[model samples]
Target: MTDVPAHVHEFDWPDRVVIGTVGLPGSRTFYLQARTGRRIVSITLEKEQSALLAEKIDEILDRLREVEGNRYSVPTSTPVELVDNDPLDTVEEQFRAGTLGIGWDPTTAQIILEAHPLPADLDEAEEFDAAASVNSEMLRVKMPVGTARAFTQRTREVVDAGRPLCTLCGHPIDPDGHTCIIPES
Candidate 1:
Protein backbone atom coordinates (compact mmCIF):
# COMPACT_ATOMS: atom_id res chain seq x y z
CA MET A 1 0.00 0.00 0.00
CA THR A 2 1.24 3.49 -0.75
CA ASP A 3 1.56 6.02 2.04
CA VAL A 4 -0.36 9.26 1.94
CA PRO A 5 1.70 12.30 0.97
CA ALA A 6 1.90 15.36 3.19
CA HIS A 7 1.61 18.67 1.34
CA VAL A 8 -0.50 21.72 0.67
CA HIS A 9 -2.29 22.16 -2.68
CA GLU A 10 -3.98 25.32 -3.82
CA PHE A 11 -6.77 25.55 -6.36
CA ASP A 12 -7.17 29.22 -7.14
CA TRP A 13 -10.29 29.11 -9.27
CA PRO A 14 -11.50 25.66 -10.05
CA ASP A 15 -13.89 24.99 -12.87
CA ARG A 16 -16.24 22.98 -10.64
CA VAL A 17 -16.37 22.05 -6.97
CA VAL A 18 -19.00 20.03 -5.16
CA ILE A 19 -19.62 17.98 -2.08
CA GLY A 20 -21.47 14.74 -2.73
CA THR A 21 -22.07 11.27 -1.38
CA VAL A 22 -22.21 7.66 -2.46
CA GLY A 23 -23.66 4.32 -1.16
CA LEU A 24 -26.84 3.80 0.79
CA PRO A 25 -28.12 6.22 3.43
CA GLY A 26 -26.78 4.38 6.44
CA SER A 27 -23.44 3.75 4.75
CA ARG A 28 -22.96 6.89 2.71
CA THR A 29 -19.48 8.24 2.16
CA PHE A 30 -19.08 12.00 1.86
CA TYR A 31 -16.54 13.44 -0.55
CA LEU A 32 -15.53 16.86 -1.87
CA GLN A 33 -14.36 17.31 -5.41
CA ALA A 34 -12.72 20.17 -7.28
CA ARG A 35 -12.07 20.10 -10.98
CA THR A 36 -10.08 22.40 -13.22
CA GLY A 37 -10.39 21.54 -16.88
CA ARG A 38 -9.48 17.84 -16.98
CA ARG A 39 -7.60 17.99 -13.66
CA ILE A 40 -9.60 16.54 -10.79
CA VAL A 41 -8.88 16.34 -7.06
CA SER A 42 -11.27 14.42 -4.82
CA ILE A 43 -11.08 14.29 -1.05
CA THR A 44 -13.20 12.13 1.23
CA LEU A 45 -14.18 13.67 4.54
CA GLU A 46 -16.24 12.61 7.52
CA LYS A 47 -19.92 13.57 7.41
CA GLU A 48 -19.30 15.93 10.29
CA GLN A 49 -16.63 17.68 8.26
CA SER A 50 -19.05 18.47 5.47
CA ALA A 51 -21.80 19.48 7.91
CA LEU A 52 -19.51 21.80 9.86
CA LEU A 53 -18.20 23.38 6.67
CA ALA A 54 -21.75 24.13 5.62
CA GLU A 55 -22.53 25.66 9.01
CA LYS A 56 -19.39 27.76 9.04
CA ILE A 57 -20.04 28.97 5.52
CA ASP A 58 -23.60 30.04 6.37
CA GLU A 59 -22.32 31.76 9.50
CA ILE A 60 -19.54 33.57 7.62
CA LEU A 61 -21.77 34.73 4.79
CA ASP A 62 -24.40 35.93 7.25
CA ARG A 63 -21.84 37.90 9.21
CA LEU A 64 -20.34 39.37 6.05
CA ARG A 65 -23.75 40.45 4.81
CA GLU A 66 -24.47 42.05 8.18
CA VAL A 67 -21.19 43.97 8.15
CA GLU A 68 -21.23 45.01 4.50
CA GLY A 69 -25.00 44.97 3.88
CA ASN A 70 -26.07 44.92 0.22
CA ARG A 71 -23.29 47.45 -0.49
CA TYR A 72 -19.99 45.58 -0.19
CA SER A 73 -20.01 42.85 -2.88
CA VAL A 74 -21.80 39.75 -4.10
CA PRO A 75 -22.06 38.37 -7.57
CA THR A 76 -25.59 38.47 -8.91
CA SER A 77 -27.65 35.37 -8.09
CA THR A 78 -27.84 32.28 -10.29
CA PRO A 79 -29.21 28.79 -9.75
CA VAL A 80 -27.35 27.07 -6.90
CA GLU A 81 -26.61 23.50 -7.93
CA LEU A 82 -23.93 21.01 -6.90
CA VAL A 83 -22.32 19.89 -10.11
CA ASP A 84 -20.03 16.89 -10.53
CA ASN A 85 -19.34 14.70 -13.50
CA ASP A 86 -19.67 11.12 -12.26
CA PRO A 87 -19.34 10.87 -8.48
CA LEU A 88 -15.85 9.83 -7.43
CA ASP A 89 -14.47 10.78 -10.84
CA THR A 90 -11.23 9.80 -9.17
CA VAL A 91 -10.97 6.68 -7.00
CA GLU A 92 -8.60 7.70 -4.20
CA GLU A 93 -8.89 10.55 -1.75
CA GLN A 94 -6.19 13.19 -1.51
CA PHE A 95 -6.89 13.17 2.23
CA ARG A 96 -9.65 12.83 4.79
CA ALA A 97 -10.27 15.91 6.90
CA GLY A 98 -8.88 16.21 10.42
CA THR A 99 -9.71 19.87 10.60
CA LEU A 100 -11.02 22.42 8.13
CA GLY A 101 -10.47 26.18 7.89
CA ILE A 102 -12.73 28.64 6.13
CA GLY A 103 -12.17 32.29 5.30
CA TRP A 104 -13.43 35.12 3.17
CA ASP A 105 -11.14 36.77 0.62
CA PRO A 106 -12.34 40.33 0.35
CA THR A 107 -10.15 41.30 -2.56
CA THR A 108 -11.34 38.54 -4.89
CA ALA A 109 -14.70 37.95 -3.22
CA GLN A 110 -13.71 34.33 -2.73
CA ILE A 111 -14.48 31.87 0.02
CA ILE A 112 -11.38 29.87 0.89
CA LEU A 113 -11.46 26.46 2.52
CA GLU A 114 -8.48 24.51 3.78
CA ALA A 115 -8.88 20.85 4.77
CA HIS A 116 -6.32 19.16 7.00
CA PRO A 117 -6.02 15.46 7.74
CA LEU A 118 -6.38 13.95 11.22
CA PRO A 119 -4.73 10.59 11.82
CA ALA A 120 -6.51 10.16 15.12
CA ASP A 121 -9.33 11.80 17.00
CA LEU A 122 -8.15 13.50 20.21
CA ASP A 123 -10.91 12.02 22.32
CA GLU A 124 -9.74 8.59 21.27
CA ALA A 125 -6.74 8.69 23.56
CA GLU A 126 -4.59 10.88 25.74
CA GLU A 127 -1.56 9.98 23.67
CA PHE A 128 -3.17 11.49 20.63
CA ASP A 129 -1.95 15.05 20.07
CA ALA A 130 -4.72 16.98 18.36
CA ALA A 131 -2.35 19.74 17.25
CA ALA A 132 0.12 17.33 15.73
CA SER A 133 -2.67 15.42 14.02
CA VAL A 134 -4.08 18.67 12.65
CA ASN A 135 -1.01 19.75 10.65
CA SER A 136 -0.41 16.41 8.94
CA GLU A 137 -1.61 17.57 5.52
CA MET A 138 -3.57 20.36 3.92
CA LEU A 139 -5.78 20.69 0.85
CA ARG A 140 -6.89 24.23 0.13
CA VAL A 141 -9.67 25.12 -2.27
CA LYS A 142 -10.72 28.65 -3.18
CA MET A 143 -13.90 29.57 -5.01
CA PRO A 144 -16.16 32.56 -5.37
CA VAL A 145 -18.62 33.45 -2.63
CA GLY A 146 -21.61 32.59 -4.76
CA THR A 147 -20.25 29.19 -5.65
CA ALA A 148 -19.27 28.57 -2.06
CA ARG A 149 -22.73 29.47 -0.84
CA ALA A 150 -24.29 27.19 -3.41
CA PHE A 151 -22.05 24.33 -2.44
CA THR A 152 -22.83 24.85 1.25
CA GLN A 153 -26.57 24.92 0.64
CA ARG A 154 -26.57 21.87 -1.58
CA THR A 155 -24.28 19.98 0.76
CA ARG A 156 -26.57 20.56 3.69
CA GLU A 157 -29.49 19.34 1.63
CA VAL A 158 -27.68 16.18 0.72
CA VAL A 159 -26.64 15.54 4.31
CA ASP A 160 -30.12 16.01 5.67
CA ALA A 161 -31.44 13.44 3.20
CA GLY A 162 -30.16 10.72 5.45
CA ARG A 163 -32.16 8.70 7.98
CA PRO A 164 -34.92 10.45 9.89
CA LEU A 165 -34.39 11.51 13.50
CA CYS A 166 -36.60 10.40 16.36
CA THR A 167 -38.85 13.14 17.74
CA LEU A 168 -38.06 12.20 21.32
CA CYS A 169 -34.32 12.03 20.78
CA GLY A 170 -31.95 13.73 18.37
CA HIS A 171 -30.36 10.44 17.37
CA PRO A 172 -31.18 8.78 14.09
CA ILE A 173 -34.07 6.32 14.08
CA ASP A 174 -32.66 2.99 13.01
CA PRO A 175 -34.68 1.08 10.49
CA ASP A 176 -35.16 -1.68 13.02
CA GLY A 177 -36.02 0.46 16.02
CA HIS A 178 -34.97 3.69 17.70
CA THR A 179 -33.98 3.78 21.35
CA CYS A 180 -35.78 7.02 21.94
CA ILE A 181 -35.59 8.84 25.24
CA ILE A 182 -39.03 9.73 26.55
CA PRO A 183 -40.50 10.68 29.92
CA GLU A 184 -42.23 7.76 31.62
CA SER A 185 -45.98 8.34 32.00
Candidate 2:
Protein backbone atom coordinates (compact mmCIF):
# COMPACT_ATOMS: atom_id res chain seq x y z
CA MET A 1 0.00 0.00 0.00
CA THR A 2 2.78 2.38 0.82
CA ASP A 3 4.53 1.55 -2.45
CA VAL A 4 7.85 1.47 -0.66
CA PRO A 5 10.68 -0.98 -0.34
CA ALA A 6 10.76 -3.92 2.11
CA HIS A 7 12.94 -2.11 4.57
CA VAL A 8 11.93 -1.94 8.22
CA HIS A 9 9.14 0.62 8.76
CA GLU A 10 10.18 3.44 11.02
CA PHE A 11 8.52 4.92 14.08
CA ASP A 12 11.71 6.81 14.87
CA TRP A 13 10.46 7.99 18.26
CA PRO A 14 7.08 6.90 19.47
CA ASP A 15 5.53 8.37 22.57
CA ARG A 16 4.71 4.84 23.73
CA VAL A 17 4.61 1.33 22.39
CA VAL A 18 3.92 -1.96 24.15
CA ILE A 19 3.30 -5.59 23.22
CA GLY A 20 -0.08 -6.96 24.33
CA THR A 21 -2.61 -9.67 23.65
CA VAL A 22 -6.36 -10.20 23.49
CA GLY A 23 -8.72 -13.09 24.29
CA LEU A 24 -8.51 -15.83 26.90
CA PRO A 25 -6.25 -18.85 27.05
CA GLY A 26 -6.61 -21.30 24.09
CA SER A 27 -7.95 -18.33 22.11
CA ARG A 28 -5.38 -15.71 22.96
CA THR A 29 -4.18 -13.39 20.17
CA PHE A 30 -0.83 -11.73 20.58
CA TYR A 31 -0.33 -8.19 19.26
CA LEU A 32 2.27 -5.45 19.05
CA GLN A 33 1.12 -1.82 19.02
CA ALA A 34 2.92 1.39 18.24
CA ARG A 35 1.53 4.85 18.98
CA THR A 36 2.89 8.19 17.93
CA GLY A 37 0.68 11.18 18.62
CA ARG A 38 -2.78 10.16 17.34
CA ARG A 39 -1.52 7.45 15.00
CA ILE A 40 -1.55 3.88 16.22
CA VAL A 41 -0.65 0.66 14.44
CA SER A 42 -1.23 -2.86 15.70
CA ILE A 43 -0.08 -6.17 14.29
CA THR A 44 -0.93 -9.68 15.41
CA LEU A 45 1.45 -12.61 15.60
CA GLU A 46 1.85 -16.07 17.06
CA LYS A 47 2.26 -16.31 20.84
CA GLU A 48 5.63 -17.98 20.46
CA GLN A 49 6.83 -15.09 18.34
CA SER A 50 5.97 -12.58 21.02
CA ALA A 51 7.66 -14.68 23.68
CA LEU A 52 10.84 -14.96 21.62
CA LEU A 53 10.89 -11.26 20.78
CA ALA A 54 10.48 -10.21 24.39
CA GLU A 55 13.17 -12.62 25.48
CA LYS A 56 15.51 -11.36 22.79
CA ILE A 57 14.93 -7.71 23.69
CA ASP A 58 15.80 -8.41 27.29
CA GLU A 59 18.90 -10.28 26.22
CA ILE A 60 20.00 -7.48 23.91
CA LEU A 61 19.55 -4.82 26.56
CA ASP A 62 21.37 -6.92 29.14
CA ARG A 63 24.32 -7.39 26.87
CA LEU A 64 24.34 -3.76 25.81
CA ARG A 65 24.42 -2.65 29.42
CA GLU A 66 27.32 -4.93 30.24
CA VAL A 67 29.39 -3.43 27.46
CA GLU A 68 28.08 0.13 27.25
CA GLY A 69 27.18 0.86 30.91
CA ASN A 70 23.94 1.69 32.78
CA ARG A 71 22.50 4.04 30.21
CA TYR A 72 20.60 1.31 28.40
CA SER A 73 20.05 -1.13 31.27
CA VAL A 74 18.80 1.32 33.87
CA PRO A 75 15.22 0.97 32.76
CA THR A 76 13.17 -1.88 34.22
CA SER A 77 9.55 -2.78 33.70
CA THR A 78 7.20 -0.52 35.62
CA PRO A 79 4.13 -1.49 37.62
CA VAL A 80 1.68 -3.27 35.36
CA GLU A 81 -1.32 -1.21 34.39
CA LEU A 82 -4.59 -3.05 34.93
CA VAL A 83 -6.20 -1.38 31.93
CA ASP A 84 -3.31 -2.22 29.62
CA ASN A 85 -3.06 -5.78 30.90
CA ASP A 86 -6.68 -6.55 30.07
CA PRO A 87 -7.01 -7.83 26.48
CA LEU A 88 -10.74 -7.34 26.09
CA ASP A 89 -10.21 -3.56 26.04
CA THR A 90 -7.32 -3.11 23.62
CA VAL A 91 -7.58 -1.65 20.13
CA GLU A 92 -8.43 -3.81 17.12
CA GLU A 93 -5.29 -5.21 15.54
CA GLN A 94 -4.43 -4.00 12.03
CA PHE A 95 -2.94 -7.35 11.05
CA ARG A 96 -1.37 -10.51 12.42
CA ALA A 97 2.35 -10.36 13.12
CA GLY A 98 4.84 -12.53 11.25
CA THR A 99 8.63 -12.27 11.42
CA LEU A 100 10.00 -10.03 14.21
CA GLY A 101 13.25 -8.15 14.67
CA ILE A 102 14.49 -6.27 17.73
CA GLY A 103 17.16 -3.68 17.08
CA TRP A 104 18.89 -0.85 18.92
CA ASP A 105 19.55 2.62 17.53
CA PRO A 106 22.64 3.85 19.27
CA THR A 107 22.29 7.42 18.04
CA THR A 108 18.73 7.82 19.25
CA ALA A 109 18.94 5.62 22.32
CA GLN A 110 15.80 3.79 21.31
CA ILE A 111 14.84 0.19 20.67
CA ILE A 112 13.39 -0.70 17.28
CA LEU A 113 10.83 -3.45 16.72
CA GLU A 114 10.19 -4.69 13.20
CA ALA A 115 7.25 -6.99 12.65
CA HIS A 116 6.64 -8.33 9.16
CA PRO A 117 4.77 -10.97 7.23
CA LEU A 118 6.12 -14.51 7.26
CA PRO A 119 8.01 -15.50 4.15
CA ALA A 120 5.96 -17.52 1.69
CA ASP A 121 8.10 -20.58 2.33
CA LEU A 122 9.88 -20.21 5.64
CA ASP A 123 10.47 -23.95 5.73
CA GLU A 124 12.80 -23.50 2.79
CA ALA A 125 14.27 -20.20 3.97
CA GLU A 126 17.93 -20.41 4.80
CA GLU A 127 18.13 -17.54 7.31
CA PHE A 128 15.64 -15.71 9.53
CA ASP A 129 17.13 -12.28 8.77
CA ALA A 130 16.64 -12.93 5.09
CA ALA A 131 13.09 -14.16 5.50
CA ALA A 132 11.80 -11.00 7.18
CA SER A 133 13.32 -8.82 4.49
CA VAL A 134 11.67 -10.66 1.64
CA ASN A 135 8.25 -9.31 2.56
CA SER A 136 7.14 -5.75 1.91
CA GLU A 137 4.71 -5.65 4.82
CA MET A 138 6.27 -4.38 8.01
CA LEU A 139 5.42 -2.28 11.06
CA ARG A 140 8.29 -0.83 13.01
CA VAL A 141 8.08 0.84 16.40
CA LYS A 142 10.76 2.70 18.27
CA MET A 143 10.65 3.03 22.03
CA PRO A 144 12.89 4.26 24.76
CA VAL A 145 14.64 2.11 27.33
CA GLY A 146 11.85 2.21 29.90
CA THR A 147 9.15 1.50 27.36
CA ALA A 148 11.09 -1.42 25.89
CA ARG A 149 11.59 -2.87 29.36
CA ALA A 150 7.91 -2.59 30.15
CA PHE A 151 7.00 -4.26 26.88
CA THR A 152 9.36 -7.14 27.63
CA GLN A 153 7.97 -7.67 31.12
CA ARG A 154 4.35 -7.46 30.02
CA THR A 155 4.96 -9.94 27.21
CA ARG A 156 6.42 -12.46 29.66
CA GLU A 157 3.40 -12.19 31.95
CA VAL A 158 0.96 -12.72 29.09
CA VAL A 159 2.80 -15.73 27.62
CA ASP A 160 3.09 -17.38 31.05
CA ALA A 161 -0.63 -16.95 31.76
CA GLY A 162 -1.52 -20.12 29.85
CA ARG A 163 -2.79 -23.33 31.42
CA PRO A 164 -0.52 -25.00 33.93
CA LEU A 165 1.73 -27.78 32.74
CA CYS A 166 1.56 -31.33 34.08
CA THR A 167 4.34 -32.34 36.44
CA LEU A 168 5.32 -35.45 34.52
CA CYS A 169 4.63 -34.17 31.01
CA GLY A 170 5.48 -30.72 29.73
CA HIS A 171 2.21 -30.18 27.85
CA PRO A 172 -0.59 -28.13 29.39
CA ILE A 173 -3.03 -30.09 31.51
CA ASP A 174 -6.68 -29.76 30.68
CA PRO A 175 -9.29 -29.11 33.34
CA ASP A 176 -10.20 -32.80 33.29
CA GLY A 177 -6.58 -33.54 34.19
CA HIS A 178 -3.88 -35.45 32.38
CA THR A 179 -2.43 -38.94 32.55
CA CYS A 180 1.07 -37.41 32.33
CA ILE A 181 2.67 -40.65 31.23
CA ILE A 182 6.33 -39.85 31.64
CA PRO A 183 7.43 -43.42 32.41
CA GLU A 184 6.97 -43.84 36.15
CA SER A 185 10.05 -44.35 38.28
Best-fitting candidate, measured by TM-score? 1
* Alpha-carbon local distance difference test for all models: 0.74, 0.70
**Per-residue lDDT over 1-185 for candidate 2, one digit per residue giving the tens place of the 0 to 100 score:** 43443554568787556667676676777777777777777777888988898889888777776775576554544535422454423476665665667888887778788777655676887765544454566787887776777778878888898778876678787666677778677
Could you give me the TM-score of model 1 versus the true structure?
Answer: 0.77
List clashing residue pairs in candidate 1.
98-118
TM-score per prediction, in order, is 0.77, 0.76
> What tens digits encode model 1's per-residue C-alpha lDDT throughout 138-179?
778888777877777778877898889877767887677778
Clashing residue pair totals per candidate (backbone < 3 A): 1, 3
Native-structure RMSD, model 1: 4.9
- What's the C-alpha lDDT at position 159 in model 1? 85
**Total backbone collisions, model 1:** 1
